[model samples]
Target: MSQMLALAILILVLFIGEAVSIRTKAWIPSIFVSGVLFLLGFWTFFPPEIVTLAGIPPAVAVMLIYLLITNMGTLLSLQELKEQWKTILIAISGILGIVAALFGIGTLLFDFQTVVVAIPPLVGGLVSALIMSEGAAAAGLPTLAVFAIVIYVVQGFAGYPLTSIMLKKEGKNLLEKFRNNELTAKQLPGEQSGTTEKTVREPRMFAKMPEKYNTDFFKFFRLALVGYLAYLTSVLLTPVVGISPFVLCLLFGVIARSIGFLERHPLQKANGFGFAIMGLLLFIFDGLKNATPSMMVEIMYPLIGCIVIGVAGMYIFSLIVGKLLKVSKEMAFAVSLTALYGFPADYIITVEVINSLTKDEQEREVLTSHMLPPMLVAGFITVTIVSVILAGIFVGFL
Candidate 1:
């Protein structure tokens, strides 16, 4: 279990994950697949030292996620959300449904510790997982800390197909509308008043770098510095305001982008930042290695119940909210499921769905432009923002 051996094993697993995902048309995300592979490898070959070696510093993960949120900020604009208020409100209602469901049904089926730990994954994303784990561990339920990560992993498997199917269906329906020349990006009432094409900017082919930063290396350094500063600010304010550092990081990212410190497409050019995220994700899997098969077996029944009940709650709530919001049930359901998958999964599924349904660039463009905003904004709302807040509160109760 030397460092080299651990790195090599991780590389091999990554390759296998990519191959399998390509072969299966990404019905399985490569990250989840790699995680399962790591689980097996850990059981078979990774000694304790190797498992330890597989992890990177937690700050690296924090900084990477901050950069990612910043990039997400660049992709969206408040003005654009004016046209997407229905989607946003529906997403919010969807989250409310999940919280209500957990308290309503979850209390009956699972004990208090299980119900509390379940809140993290139900809220969704890695940030929620880490926050809830820390909260649970602080409350002296160390075993429940592990449940946060386990539930995060379990949600992905339960969520993937449902998300995929919804996206595909939405794409198909949108494509048909395009063929009939009926699809248009409508500005729903209460959306901010503006021209159809507002001033929200896309990543330019050439980003203008600030003076003293001439190279891509320097540009990335500046972005990383912004993220680091944001993290530090969050730490300083957490005692006063009691918000998660990650949320502060996301806010700072949006602010930095607004002021022109970070580029619009940081992920495209920030190779180091991308590697940090990859390493951090690997670290998450390494944490999973700590959970032996026996540990998983103990919670399997409750885990299944969580997944089934959580997803069902989302769909049922979406139905009620969608009608109120004037969004179709299908779109509402797809967006609600973001509670389970979040981020790149939401982004990836949207792209894959559009690609599968249409070849015409114009049609694809129309669908993508419409579909992406809701998914992106919804993910930011549920996974990045509310989830962390909910985890913060729920952990205390536990």
Candidate 2:
């Protein structure tokens, strides 16, 4: 009975935190709401005795995973991603490369403690969020709770400043492009081409293009379908293939786009925002499952080290990748920043930076469009893989 109330309290606080996010529009993102709740749980601020629970239930992760993957599939198919592939690729390359390198470094530096003494999660994907949470608790790694706290703290805090600064460079031109409805459309020169014909048939309504996109049920349903399918596949493969389903879902998203299973903006801005909220809640609750006073005190050093490496490394890697890819110098930087921090961070940062640079409508929107794909994709995959592992392991499964 008490546990049920504790869970309810978490929901209320997290919801309120999201409200704070909507109102402020500041660097402090909504994930912070969940992060703070997690901290409170670890600290025993509420009923206090709820802290006695050693790990999260398997059900928590399953629900979060399902929702997140659904969001990922829907988001991956959005118009924003279709338009800005290069920027995303370049930045992701840098992000993945750097994290991989760091993971190796962590393995060496931390003596390969498996859960605590290693770096598998650092560069693998955002699924590390779950792994960090669940793995730490279940493995009984030292300072497991602290590591979870730091991971989200870095994620939430880095999002704002980094994204704003990066996007600021794209400026007015990007905004004007959107305002003028100039999203650069190309059609088949001849009506005979199937590609051109399909695009024409689906000419989207500009009226609903504003941020609140997925109000319609069909769009939501499609996203949910794909996401759940990915989850199902992930589960099936877990026993047979012994691999994470998130990787498959991500591949599914990429393939879905490539094969033209979906080619529209499925993730309205509101939907993406909601998706982020759900992911973070799973991230926090599952992460706290194993956090006890004794464990948090053990491996504080590596926990601190990981956060420092993650936040700073992601930021620098994005810039380098952007330049190598030869995207608009401005666009690359903005996009790279988004890749580093994830969605809202990238959006907030891009808006601020763009507002500073140019009032040109076309360029501003272009820059914004460029930044969105990388951040959203990166956010979805990274959060999916890491958070899942974190939660699953802590639940004593996976």
Candidate 3:
């Protein structure tokens, strides 16, 4: 295919997947849909180099990962992070549950190598999957590499409905509380509850600079600098400390944001986040090029085993942690499942459940206020922070 045609085909597939996801209210994830299409396309007529032809080379994807991870740091403020400590503890415990189950039972059903390759993606999302995929490929284990991608592609099917059910139950319970006047819409600390007034805090590092002077190019430049520094620190410390560059990028991104060295949502501010993410997704799909129907079938035993065990682990651990923390089991379990599909899905499912349970704006606000923070925090802690760190460490085992 021509370069333009190849790029168009790739983008078209992503567009269709996104459309389907939105239409389904994220019952079906965009990644799952796009991943299936890519697999089918590669198994049939698509060129193995279609991703490259689409102009998203491996190097470009790697660069985007660094920048995007750094941008993720700007997603939450230090106070926001501190306020979600309970969510963080619960989420991390749930991941540990997955690890325990996988190591304890998964190793028995599958080989140790198989369990090692499976755990990262099971505990996190695309980045963890990418880390495992790349690690498996480097270790000359093509099947394991494909296994990582397959795990990431399908794990959401298990997570979405389960999380939706839990959230719905939690929402209804909250609605009951709202009706009884036991619950009320309340603003988070330092945040205004209603939309009547907006809080606009100036960036500390650039407080004196006018908004117009903080151009897109400047944001990109700052983001790139942070990414570079992260890479450099990883190079110096990884061998000695066993940290991944991706993890460093995330840490440095958070620190940079906290210190006001970078703006909030730097990539989005630069208007480059979407394309950067698309490039990373394309790079992930590139692994599908080598997968065949037979290979997929061969890996099914371990595939099914890992997911079942992993999620079971998440449930048990989440419940334990929730009880100790005095959090409701349903909400805690829902938070734990963020490991399966993070971010937009976690956010989407919460909103969908809240919308389904109540039409009253005040009630909706109360439910959202109660549920959304924990879910978002759980996702950030598990997928954004812990997963990358785990993947970096786990890949070494593989």
Tens digit per residue, CA lDDT, model 3, 102-182? 999988889998999888888787778989999999999988999998887767768877887898788888888889988
lDDT of 1 by residue, 106-192 (tens): 889889788888876776787778888888888898878888888887677677677767777777787788678888654431123
1-398 in candidate 2: lDDT tens per residue?
A: 36666556666766776566555542334555555567666666644334233223445445545444444453444444455566556556545544555565655655444334223344333445445656566667545434554444444444454444444434445455656887552321112335453354321333235525434555555555666677688787777755565556555654454344433434543255454444445444444545555555665566556645654665566556666666555555444444334533443344444444555665554654454555555554444444344344433522
Best lDDT among the predictions, by candidate number = 3
Task: TM-score each candidate.
Answer: 0.82, 0.59, 0.79
Question: RMSD to the native, candidate 2?
Answer: 7.8
| Local lDDT at 363 for model 2 | 57
Q: Local error of candidate 3 at 335, Å?
A: 3.2
lDDT values for all models: 0.71, 0.49, 0.81
**Higher-lDDT candidate of 1 and 3:** 3
Clashes of 1: 1
